[model samples]
Target: MASARLERGVVVGARLLVAAVFVAAAVPKILDPAGFAAAIRNYQAFPYWSWNGLAVGVPMLEVVGALALLSGWKRQAGALLLGGLTLAFVALITSVIVRGIDIGCGCFGQSEAAESVGWPLLVRDLGLLAAIVVAAREPGPLRAARVR
Candidate 1:
């Protein structure tokens, strides 16, 4: 039916948009790991030594997830992971905001404003979550493996 085609088109568009956002975000952090480490430090969440680890690990995960989303490979798993990450971010940011701890979001590295957990951040995370949820709801294009 025409309606089915329209729905599929919408889903595909949403997937691409979400993948693009993650890819864009990952590039900056990947390009400047040291800067991103500094941004993590600004967040004041972890110990001094852990910032570097997070800076490296976080971006790697983001890049992988972004690629998976873009490729439509293991789509269900990738979308679920992304959705969980977004939920965690939303929770973390909300907690920081409630505690009145103003600091950089460190989302894509440090911002000139030292991006705090503000309304815009919340909205962005929520949007990402919604997109991931939509992606997960669709049937994955990947083939299933047999356990034997």
Candidate 2:
């Protein structure tokens, strides 16, 4: 019983962590779409024409997914969305490193001092992905075991 309770706690904690990450990542992009678009363009993963759309769309998705995770309704779906986004980020970051392109991660926001893409960023994204996967595997909040 205690083990179950502990597992539930871990799941809830992971969910909240992932939710916070998504929300944090989304807000800056939403607030400054043009800057975010430039950041996306720096990646060179997508065409210039698509930057604006992606800049707007990605942040919106992050907000919606984060809200869903926090609300405990459709949490699994949110986790899946976050997981996919994290995977894409890891891939993009990896590509930039492999290609020797020095650019901001464009993850948190579009700041002039945004951190450059590197292995640390890739590891962080992978960690978030792991958290999402763990949270997604658990039952919903109400079904989680409660410790005395």
Candidate 3:
């Protein structure tokens, strides 16, 4: 019984943490899409035209998915979206590193204090992936644990 409680505690903690990070990251970009667009341009991952649209859309999607995860109403869908975003970021950052591109991650939007793309950033994202993987592997619906 103790073990079960411990595991559930861990799952709840992970979901809260992941949701917090996504919400924090999304808010800045949502507030400053022009800055985000400039940062995306630095990565040169997508076409020039798509950068603006992505900057506008990605943060909104992040918030929606995060809220879903936090609320446990559509946890699976949220996990899928967040997992996909995390995976895509890993790939994008890896490509940037391979090409010797020196740029901030723009993870929390473009800022003087933005984290640069590097192995550390990759590791952090990987940790988030692992957390999401754990959440995804839960045996039943998360709504069971959701507070009324």
Best by lDDT: 3
For each of the candidates, give the backbone clash count.
0, 0, 0
Q: Where does model 2 exceed 4 Å of error?
A: 139-148
Runs off by more than 4 Å, candidate 1: 111-114, 139-148
List the candidates' TM-scores in order: 0.84, 0.91, 0.92
User: What are the lDDT figures for the candidates, one per model?
Assistant: 0.76, 0.87, 0.89
Predicted model with the maximum TM-score: 3
lDDT (Cα, tens digit) per residue for candidate 3, span 20-130: 999999999999999999999999889999999999999998999889888887899999999999999999989998999999999999889999999999999999999
User: Once model 2 is optimally superposed onto the true structure by TM-score, how far is the C-alpha of residue 85 displaced, in angstroms?
Assistant: 0.9
lDDT of 2 by residue, 1-148 (tens): 6666677788888888888889999999999999999999999899889999999999999999888887878977887787788888989999999999999988989887899999988888888888888878665443643422
Rank candidates by TM-score, best first.
3, 2, 1
Candidates ranked by lDDT: 3, 2, 1
Better of 2 and 3 by TM-score: 3
> Between which residue pairs do clashes occur in model 3?
none
